[model samples]
Target: MRRSGPVRALLAASAAAAVSAGLVVAGGGAAQAAPAFRAPMPAHVVAPYYETYAGGSPAALAAQSHNTYLTLAFLQTPAAGSCTATWNGDATTPVSKSVYGKDIAALQARGGNAIPSFGGYAADTTGTDIADSCTDVSSIASVYEGLVTTYGVTRIDLDVEADSLSNTAGIDRRNKAVAQVESWAHRTHRNVQFSYTLPSTTTGLGATGVALLQNAVANHARVDVVNIMTFDYYDGASHEMATDTETAAAGLINQLAALYPSEKPSHLWSRVGVTDMPGIDDFGPAETFTTADAATVEHWAAAKGINTLSFWALQRDNGSCVGTAGAGACSGVAQSDWYFSHTFEAFTHSKWTWGKGRSPWSEPKPAPRQAERGSRM
Candidate 1:
């Protein structure tokens, strides 16, 4: 169930993590161990998305092999305002593949946890995003709440990109839906959190993305994370892909710190996340998230206390497939399978604990601040 507000819900989640392991909760899957409450605290998270095989069984990439949490990708609501979660497209009919209800159950049963990501670049042929198809925002939120309740998940990731980003009206609709989902979580005594997945520029969130965050803040949506899709910068080879990503992240962190002026720098960064395509992006050969660049991005996240680190898809985590914008099968790199994930996973381990304020990789803890303000509830 939900709480009074984001602060109460977040605090409750953190407390749940402290409880013994066998404690179970019910939501989008079978009754299972509640997904740990690990936000607002330091976590070495290497969460990646699953797309190529998202509609099929999830055993191919082995989500647990290198990531602490895997992101179930593109839980799109179909066109014509159906609001039913589907994979990567606009279809009048339902996709036969079992998704949130079954696939999620299977993964969690195997000791894996994931956050459902809504929307993606694969919007409909006309550039309409999944979130935009719905005129009834509350209905959209109801679907999201149903997933959280069924899976016992800790969070819902709104991957707002493509046409949706520019749709200011749609952004407001999304913000309202998210706020309602958080409210439902409060009422249900479930601790479901929220995050936004937006595209970024080298310097940070663009005006559109910033507006999305602003709208959420204005709507009182408790966004626990602001995940930046850090690839696809088409600036004519002007900036190194990885370094530009850091620049983008640094800017976003500063923007967030300014927005929630009370939040500590470290805490603000902890709410920031980065996810780049593993290799070439859809923008042709403009840039590629090369294998070597993986360390730079993940290490930067570690040193800066970035909360979540993710790549595009698990299917592309291999080195065998090269060239082409990362669609599926491989990341178009020159390394072995799971190389990027393995490197990014390096940031995660038992060294850091929740609410510790800092990771071993980060500089020694800053003067203690109001830990409650860390969540900026």
Candidate 2:
């Protein structure tokens, strides 16, 4: 998720309070109920992110847009050294229903669920990313487990980018924690999965992103998804948005093939996910994702059998701020409300197969390109 303005100096004086019997204490003496458990996300999904800090009701938006899943962004520590993780780095919004429990439950009741994402651009740069702020591997794992038990979510997205990508210690600690949490999940019979969302070039992940995944492999952490931000090339070149998305994803699959050499081509495709910014991304008009691009990507994703098809946000699904760069409330293009959501919701259907396939928009599986080794994507 994109963050703007000055980073706040918020502080949480103590570590995260322990989860007590699936409940966490909230402000005003309210004991929020734990969200009811929901089935794991389908093998293929169209879960556009809902910006939690943007003050929108996730459930209401899902219903309005007819989307079954949303990746909530993001959870972070309140202070630089705090071990606790909270929504938008606010101490009051810990892993509890009060923060978004009701919304998640409501979504689940409608046969939908939410995926809690951690470490966006702001959290990654501020030293407030949970693993960066907390040194203890156990504590970081506990925080992750708390999120799962509190919300009953099946997947967690670690939006590892910015400075978090280079923090070697933090990266190691995070992967260790992820391994620990996966072990706990296996023992508890919980369906927990982790995804590493990293920035990418027009081609694929750079050395830092590859290093992060390499460490995850080293620590025996299972990464279910390698979702890349497909927009925001910011490389001073005009982009055919949908084509770049396909190439970038193809490039990622190539990289994943090298990373998990034992996996088959189809399996690596199943582990792939691409996140497109709906309209104009942070890089302005040179990288606009039009409604046509959405349809093109959707069809391509369905054909390729990618694991996930998501955009930067559901909030920016409209054209309320045309020609703007990275508008939080609206996509900077002229379109009907929720057009992207409606277009992508087709991806939620389970009919797609993760087998060797082809599409009119699909890029041929490319060999790992040595020339495509750079940081910014």
Candidate 3:
């Protein structure tokens, strides 16, 4: 997405604020004191999947232990002629089918929460309308309630994202759909967590998209979490990662926090999202390093009172680390080496030390020797 117009304005304002404070590069993963405004509890990283496990069982376990949250569900439609009936194409029969039920049972068994998300990035006007209908609401809710009751689920993640925000009818349908889902969430008495995969840059979604999210958050108090898609900023085209990417991502989160401070449960619930790719073919040649870079970004967000860190996929980041020696034989190949080698380091280094005397968003400046490399968005 092009970073211009309103987004450019927001970026400029954020850049000015950071420049006034004298931007400093920091090194080391030492726990830093929290600023006055401490973020809420730390949220976990989620992995995306259709039906099969991309990262396999080991990856799932690693993710569960590394973070407190897990999402093991997908987008699907309610079964035909059945109220509150939902089923996925990948799984045979409805959610009650042995295979589907087994999947939900396994996720719950692992101490991870499983929720069947509804809509995604693609435009689904008909689906949105069905979701908006009163009849559909009860049906979908019934299905969700059944899943919760059967699988012992405690939370639901609603993945609602649509393409056309400019049209009046489209906006109305989107709002109605959200309202219906929110209502169902309340009726079920389960923690309904609303998440989205937004563009990493402020301009990534264009003016219409930004307005849609802003309006929704402002009006819908029940919407819990907004998980922005923070990766894919450069698409491997630019050798120099723009300071704008960092500024824009942080600025967008700050803007939302300021807008909905009272509505949000805690500071930690406020998230400046990003995606991690173990290795992407498009991001030029992969440069391996210590877990220092990932830790730096986490620390930056922590200091700013943003606690949620989301990776795009579990399978992608699971790779071998080539270190500073540059690309080796498996330079661009997706190996489990990097993820295995750095998972421990990344998780350990992400710890934030908040105290009574420090600012909510404060972190030790990076040591002079540390260099900022191209981010793995």
Candidate 4:
């Protein structure tokens, strides 16, 4: 997702375990480190993307906010024409214990884990997305395998947006690499999952998003989740963000039915994910996602059994910049600190019921009348 602001300065990498014990490269960087303890992702989860560039301890934040899982955004090559993946594209923060290892271990100690993501807006716009920057398919797969061993994360998120979405060659290379990684994981008896985060229209994923998944199917890549960015339509229409999320997701479910004809509607719902941009998104007041929207979406997602519920960034789950659109550090709405986190975290163990004789995965109800659009918050 695009955070409309200047790129924050990269934080100095933390010093922890020695590289010799933390990671060892072999076979042209295709080797894995000794496995660490990792908890499997819950059947349902609420893992907000945590901005690593903006300095803070993820484990500490997770504890304070009562969040057990966080999608770390993002890891990419430090420059064009390089195959090495590092946090915030900084060479100092290589995929080793010297980076966020201790924090991840701490979170895992608390029965939580981190999901490292790749290719956010900046990496997609530049030619630094791992698959786009690196020509070697094996090397891309190696980077993914390295994350699983080094961090012991159960899930990896690929945030495909901006220019990266249109690069068909990059898309193919990515899916192919994912297939390779899954093959390796199976051989090693490792548990890992992949999720693609794509931008969506009100009705559903655009053609490119569908094509991306189609290619995944063609390549025999197992995509455990297809997460849609529910905010930022930018279509110049006044939006009730909560209602749009429902329609957009319903449209996506129908599309998935076409893609996976053998799966039941209930099973398909388990593969769907929704990500909201809290408060005001990049396009400003017309697309504000309010506190009420969070409650509505949480209940809807629980009832439908969606795989995940997340927002753009955990740091923005506050009222620091009310009325300011797309501020990186705040939600731009009046909400208590960590309100979104506390609200969304409930989905991890959510159990909501639909009315009698109604299947949870059946057709969505018509959106409540367009929320009274009065003053722009």
Candidate 5:
């Protein structure tokens, strides 16, 4: 969903740390049926990268099995070496502006939540590079903790990639700061959950990602999920996007096995998540992750007990025109509104209670199609 900037080349070029090769957490014993891992209720079909452009969908999203729209940014200021946060990209509009109060309230009304995502692709130039800029880990911890406390969120995801991932020093600071936040949350009994969103290939995480995960495991950083952005493979792009996703996940699973030798295959899979670019990706027309691809990947991820499933954005899952190129607002495909959301809804229902029962969302479906509005990748 973010700018990769020659991702495959980077992963290939960076020396793979002598750590585990690949993985995503799995859960359960063989006797139990392969049930869907309902990511904490009102948390399935999680969608990040939600900027102001996505205006209004809290009601629709909550009703359609969507939960937790990861508000785009918790940007940090550069000069002070301290921190300040914004919900959108605008530096002037601090999150305290209450720009998202209404949306957050609406989602909460539906028993959903808004999780804050930090350090995205633009972390390098935007002055939000927490990893590199926040050398004072405590200050950054306060920043993240403030946002989480404000939002009353139980989970926080760090979309670490691009420049954010490459800096070794920043990675160290990030892991430590995040662990500190976890410590605070535990003390306050907030039961906060931490996860990482890293770039990946069919084989495994790049050197930076591997190092981050290794550090988390080694430091005992209570990481709840390791979600990989399984798209924009570029040179590594494959015809079968779903199969490519499976291959990529398999590699990660094996690596996780080595990291947590004591955990079973099911536990490792349960801790794993895969974020896909469900349609034409940013690279161009050549790389397209389709609806059918979403179905196949959903089935496999569900069968394997993959913890969570998501895509680059929600603004794009429409039948709007995207021409021949990819557009960020509309998934470049001919389909009904929220088609992608419905497809991904497959993963939201049915709890995988470790050999227990499975249940589906009996909520209301979308209304009759209207003159829907949209833009593109």
Candidate 6:
């Protein structure tokens, strides 16, 4: 669904404010202006998953100005000296020696944050299945504490999406898992951030899904964000296929906002949101990076008062666009292109400004072309 006219007007106004002070590139030759003050979204954090092999590389992490990288979880047995499985089925090793140190150091050196995640999509290859046994709390806590002390990471994301949420036992187990983690984070003197990645609301997963998540967030005081997995809705239904993914995302945000108020005396509304890995399939038959679609999603988020805006990934759609025909340089590099273009365009064309009184990263303004020598003389 397209953004309502009023919402579009708001976006336009925001863009204009951002541009006047040179928060974004106005054109190729325009001179850079002094920075302006703009309030940033309180929790505008991006959580890119850094593969273990991809660890120790600051180049990619530095380019994005990302706030956090939710490193893939470590699965290990409960035994004291048991080996741990990294996300990619790589050889098991101690958290201190291998992945944790390497990943955190690289990201931190680049001024980015890293958080260790516990559970992922894969089944329990790690002999100790925390999901199966709530009693493994101490072992889970031990790993979490060790990572924090070793890597100096303050955040921890728990990706708890499992195969079933239909039964009470399942939901209870999920709740306990969160409680255990929060308890450990408190004891460690580390301000840990907790979150869950669940399917979007459209799926027939029902209130059980919502209940389990809401309970987890409420009971576990330290939980900070709940990232809704809003993409991959390929259910063979026309409505599901044809629905404007952004609008659907907006509605979900609104629902969560209402459920968790910003002014609540206790928590930060644990900002409700949706994330998608933008791709040809995301656009369906249109097969393109729909600027209008992206705008609509942003507008919906702003209008509904959602606290954060995140995508499933950054690398996927950085600088590419697909059209009715197929994918190519229909525009530019998908993910990177959109990030730079939209980020600048939003400043030039909308109201949001950079948080640090400067653009996240600066590009040099083009030099003026030389005047025609003969004609001028």
- Residues forming the 10-long window of minimal summed lDDT in candidate 4: 9-18
Model 5 lDDT tens row, 1-377? 35322211112211121012111111111111211111232333455445333343333333432443544444545432446545444565555415454445445544455666776666654546666766777777777776554545556778787777767777777788777877765444344566788888878787778888888876667667788888787774445678878988998888888888988888888778888776778766666788788888878877887766777765556656555345655677776766776776667664653432211211122233333221000
Any idea what lDDT model 6 has?
0.41
Pick out the ten consecutive residues of candidate 6 with the lowest summed lDDT: 1-10
Give stretches of model 6 more than 4 Å off: 1-42, 51-61, 64-85, 124-129, 133-135, 162-174, 203-205, 214-222, 237-270, 281-292, 299-307, 319-377
- Cα-based TM-score, every candidate: 0.77, 0.86, 0.57, 0.85, 0.77, 0.59
Question: Where is model 1 more than 4 Å wrong at Cα?
Answer: 1-42, 52-55, 89-102, 124-130, 284-286, 323-327, 350-353, 356-377
Model 6 per-residue lDDT tens digits across residues 302-353 = 4433333454333333443334222221222234443522432232222333
Ranking the candidates on lDDT from highest down gives 4, 2, 1, 5, 6, 3
Which has the better TM-score: candidate 2, or candidate 5? 2
- Candidate 3, residue 146: how far the Cα is off, in Å: 4.9
Show where candidate 4 strays beyond 4 Å: 4-39, 352-377
lDDT head-to-head 3 vs 5, winner: 5
Candidate 4 Cα lDDT to native? 0.79
Cα distance off (Å), candidate 4, residue 197? 0.3
Reference-based lDDT, each prediction: 0.63, 0.79, 0.38, 0.79, 0.60, 0.41
Q: Under the 3 Å rule for N, CA and C atoms, how many clashes does model 5 have?
A: 25
Residues 99-172, candidate 1: write the lDDT tens digits. 33444444455455567777766652233454687777877787676565455566678877666778887789
Q: Across residues 257-306, which tens digit of lDDT does each residue of candidate 3 receive?
A: 65566644334334444433233322344322223444555555554444
Which portions of model 2 show Cα errors greater than 4 Å? 4-37, 354-377
Q: How many steric overlaps does candidate 3 have?
A: 25
Residues 168-233, candidate 2, lDDT per residue (tens digit)?
999999999999888876655456778889999889898999999999999999898899999888
Clash counts for the predictions, in order: 22, 2, 25, 0, 25, 18
Q: What stretches of model 3 exceed 4 Å from their correct place?
A: 1-68, 78-88, 91-93, 100-110, 121-147, 158-188, 202-205, 218-221, 234-245, 261-272, 281-293, 305-307, 320-377
For the record, the alpha-carbon RMSD of candidate 6 to the native fold, in angstroms, is 15.9
